[model samples]
Target: MPFSTLGLSEPLLKALADLKYSEPTAIQKKAIPVILSGKNLVAAAQTGTGKTASFVLPMLEKLNTERKLRGKRIRALVLTPTRELAVQVEQSIRDYGQYLNLSSMAMYGGTDIEPQRQKLIWGVDIVVATPGRLLDMAHQRALHFDELEVLVLDEADRMLDMGFIEDINKIIERLPLERQNLLFSATISDDVRALSKRTFSNATEISIGNNNASKPKIDQWLITVDKGNKSALLSHLIIEHQWQQALIFIETKHGAAKLVSQLEKRGISAESIHGGRTQAMREQVLNDFKAGKIKFLVATGIASRGLDIGELTRVVNYDLPDQVDDYIHRIGRTGRAGASGEAVSFVAKDNFRNLCAIESRLGHVIKRKEFEGFPVKKVVPLSILNYVPKNKR
Candidate 1:
């Protein structure tokens, strides 16, 4: 159904139209109505399923109808796992709430704390923050949630994985007990469920897909090569396929930087973002990539979650992630918003265990193909083979 049928206001519908969001995804359809009802909600949907917009739209609608003053108190608070994700969510709020008069700000580390404190003093209706920075601000008494009407824990699973449960609990304890609480996660494991139960009261729970499920619109491909030749394979695929833009993930910050340097030597426009760089550098690289100024972006797992790029068509795994969940997050970067895309991974002998774990998580074998010039020096593990359909093998 169209967004209009979901009870969003004209301004939000207009914003969605301008943004070309014609219809809601399954998660959006299920979660929006429940969220709009002012009930606590715990939603589990895979990344790239428009989970951001599901909660964002309803929260904007709620804020629009409220008549509260917003000078000293944050009316809505969104907590994210990383600075990049916090900025991304803030951008979505600005884009989707473009027509509204709401004021929003993103608070994260790697920036001057004084400027953020000043922004809070100037006042904002919504605050999107990373747990650490928000905790810092709270300790300094720079922000308060006395008037908070809604609280969102975006990427709840990731926050827990990142060891932010104590900070999250501390933040929650400061908020008024009667406010709406919403928790959204790509995967709702036992820990996530227990956290939700402890925080939410009689919440509506919605699981749109199985945990770590790969997006169907993504055509996943695997190529086996020698460990040292991954860069060659990546460059070959990008040039041969005429890929205009590709988000490439590596295993280390140093690896990301090295790959970008190699790509540049090959006359490719590439950039890298990882924990080693300051937050400003990462933000600038992400902006350039989104604007199509940089065709190739080499990133560590830091870019995996909550990094949304419009019409991103390619995601290459220069190095396989350590966790299957991360593999899903990396591939989910492409094929977003119902768009078809491709995910190609350069697998070496050392990455076999990661590949096997990923295949097992998805309950199927990824399509494996040998590139014309790149010959496989390693064997595809029998475990991965076991998950392959008999006809395909």
Candidate 2:
């Protein structure tokens, strides 16, 4: 359905049209109306299913009316888990709310607090922030939530996984008790359900494209090779497949750097993004990747949640994620917004357990393919569904 049919104002529709968005995504179609109704919402959809707009569009429409500001008060507060995600959400707000008079900011650390403080002096209409940084402003009396009309927890499950529950509670405790609340998560795990139960009131719950509902539109496959032959195998696949672009996931910052160097040595230029780099560098890499200036991006899990490349066609696991859920987020970087994509993984015998956990969570075995010269020295067994995945965090 069109966004106009979902009760959004002309300005929002115009902005969306300018961005070439022809229709609402499934999450947008369901959540937008519920949000416009001013009711609490608990929405679940996988990454890249347009979850960001599901909340941002409706919230902007609801907060388009101007209100008198006092003591740095914001009308809507969006809490995200990572600094990158905070920046991403605020950009979407600006992109969609450009024709409106509303103001928005992406608040987070890795930058001077004074600048953020100054922006909060008059208050923005919408503030997308990380929980710790949000609390920092709260403690200094920089932002007032007394007048907050909407509270949105983007990637609520991720925030909880990062152990931001106390900060979330503290922030929620200060908001007006009778405001709209929305919780959005990629997966509705047991923890997410509990969070919704405790936080949302009389909310409409929605879940789409998860588990048995259907697997995402990604052609997932893996190649089993020796640890020493992994990089060579990747280079071979890139050349053989003639992939225009791919996002490769590594396990650590060192591993990320090493893989990029290896790719460069093979005459394929690549860049890496990880927590070890400064925020500016990471942002630049993300921009380059999106702009197609960089054909390949090697990232750690840090980029998995926040990196939104609309046309990213492939994501490769140079190293399989130890966390089972990360398998979902890493591959989700591709195959976004109902587009077909591919997810590739390089597995060594040592990664057998991790593979099992990931496959069990996926509820199916990823097809195995092999290169002619890259023979597996140690055979990797198929996934045994009952294997419990352990989070090394």
Candidate 3:
């Protein structure tokens, strides 16, 4: 169904048209009407399903038709887990609300607080922030939640995983008791469900796609290589494909930095981003990579959630994540917005168990293909034989 038939205001419909959004995604179609009806909602949707617009567009419409705040008080508060996500949501709000008089700003740590304080002082219609920094500002009397009309927890599962539950609770306590709440998560874990119970009363629930939906558009394949030659194989593949842009995921911050250095030594324009880097640096690296100034971006789990890079051609898993769901999120970086893309993973002998676990969770084995020159022998190493496949043994 088209977004125009969703009972949206004429201005919002016009804004969506200008953005060239011809159709409503499943999540958008299900959630928009419920949200517009002024009901609290718990939405489960995977990344790249246009979940951002499901909430942003409806919220913008509500704000446009409702009363405005009188002072420097925030009316809508969006809490995200990372600085990148906060900036991303704020930008969407600005884009959707451009036709209205609404104002928005993003605040997070790893930067000077003075400028953020100034932005709060000047007033904004919506504030997108990380919990820690927002709490600090609230405690210092630099911000107020008395006028809050809606509270949104974007990436709610990630917030719980990052141990931000206490911060989230504190922020909730500061807000008025009668405000509306919306929770959005890629996957609804037990912890997230419990949090939703406390945050929303009589909430409507919506799920966009299947729990194990396969992004058929993404061409997925695995390459088995020796642990020592993994980096060499990656460098060779990048050069061989002549890919203009690729986002590579590693398991650790240290690993990301080391890989970036290795790629740079081979004359590849690359940069690394992770939790250890300052927010400003992370933003710069992401911007540069998206703009094609850098050919490759190496990141850890930080880039796996709520980050949308348009038309990403390929995603490389340099090292497998411990959790099966993370593997799904890592490869989801590509094949976004109806664009066909590719995902390649390097699985070494030591990571065979992880590969098996991933296959079990996916309920199907991922096809393995060997590169012509970079062949891996079928025999299993004796020491790690127990972890290898029975057929290989």
Candidate 4:
């Protein structure tokens, strides 16, 4: 259905139209109305399904219609896991709320706190922040949550995985007890449920898909290759497919750097990003990748959650993530916004356990495809294979 029919105001609708959002995604269609009614929510949706807009749009409408907040006290707080995600969420809020008088800013670590403090002094209607940085500001008496009307935990599952649960709990304790809470996650693990129970009262739970479900639009394929030849296989596939832009997922910062260097040696424009890189350099690499200056970006899981690269043609798993949930998020980097995308994984014999775990989480065997140059000669002996269903084997 058209966004106009979703009961959004003319000004907000106009901003969406200007942004070329013709219609709402499934998550938006389902979550927006409930959020507009000022109810607590627990929404689980896949990445790239316009999840950001689902919350941002309704939040804008609510903030615009509600009583305005008095000086500098934040009325809305959005907590994300990483600095990039905080910035992205703030940008979405600003973009959608441009026609409104609402003010917002993003605060995170790895940067000077004085600038964020200065911005907070001027007053903001919404504050998007990482939990650590937010708590720091609150502890320093540079920020207050007394006026918080709405609390949103964007990517709550990731926050839990990153060991931010304690920080999240501390932040929640500082907010008013009667405030509305919204929690969104790609997967609803046991920890997510526990956290939601603590943070949201009588929350309406919305699950768009089964937990850790792969995006249907993504064509997933697995290729078995020698562990030493992963880089070579990746380079071959990129060259074979003639991908315009690809994001390669690796497990470590050092691996990302090595993969980028290898790709560059193959005459491909590549860059790497991880926590080791300065925030400015990370942002620059991301910008260059999005701008098409870099044809390939090798990144650790840090880039998996909130990095939005438009029309990403391929997502290659240079190394399988240790956690099965991460496999879902890594592949989600591509096939976004209803675009067809490809996900290729290079699995080695020794990594069979990881593969089996991923298959178990996906509830089916990921189809195997042998690359022309990279062929599988033998099946790896995975102890987990004994636990697989006969049909799956």
The model with the greatest lDDT is 2
| TM-score against native, each model | 0.65, 0.67, 0.63, 0.67
Root-mean-square deviation of Cα positions for candidate 2 versus the true structure, in angstroms: 7.4
The lDDT of each candidate is: 0.83, 0.84, 0.81, 0.82
Q: Model 3, 1-393: lDDT tens per residue? A: 788888888878888888998999999999999998999999999889999999999888888855656656888999998888999999999887778888899998768998999888766789999998999899888988888889999988667645577789999988898887899987666668889998768999887776334333688888889777788898888899787788898978999889989988998889998888777787788788888898898988764444557678898888877877677666766775456889888888878778878877665567777677776764323223335576764
For residue 153, give model 2's deviation from the true position in Å: 4.7
Candidate 4 yields a Cα-based lDDT of 0.82
Best-to-worst order by lDDT is 2, 1, 4, 3
Alpha-carbon runs more than 4 Å astray in model 3: 1-38, 42-75, 79-111, 118-126, 130-149, 153-179, 183-201, 205-216, 303-306, 375-393
In model 4, the runs with Cα more than 4 Å from the true position are 1-38, 42-75, 79-112, 121-125, 130-147, 153-178, 183-199, 204-216, 303-305, 372-379, 382-393
Please provide the root mean square deviation of candidate 3 (C-alpha atoms, Å).
Answer: 7.1
Error of 4 at 301 (Å): 2.1
Q: Which stretches of candidate 1 lie over 4 Å from their true place?
A: 1-38, 42-76, 80-111, 118-149, 153-179, 183-201, 205-216, 303-306, 384-393
Whole-model lDDT, candidate 1? 0.83
Question: Higher lDDT: candidate 2 or 3?
Answer: 2
- A best-first ranking of the candidates according to their TM-score comes to 2, 4, 1, 3
Supply candidate 3's per-residue lDDT for 98. 76
- In candidate 3, list every pair of residues with a backbone clash: none
Model 2 residue 247 lDDT score: 89
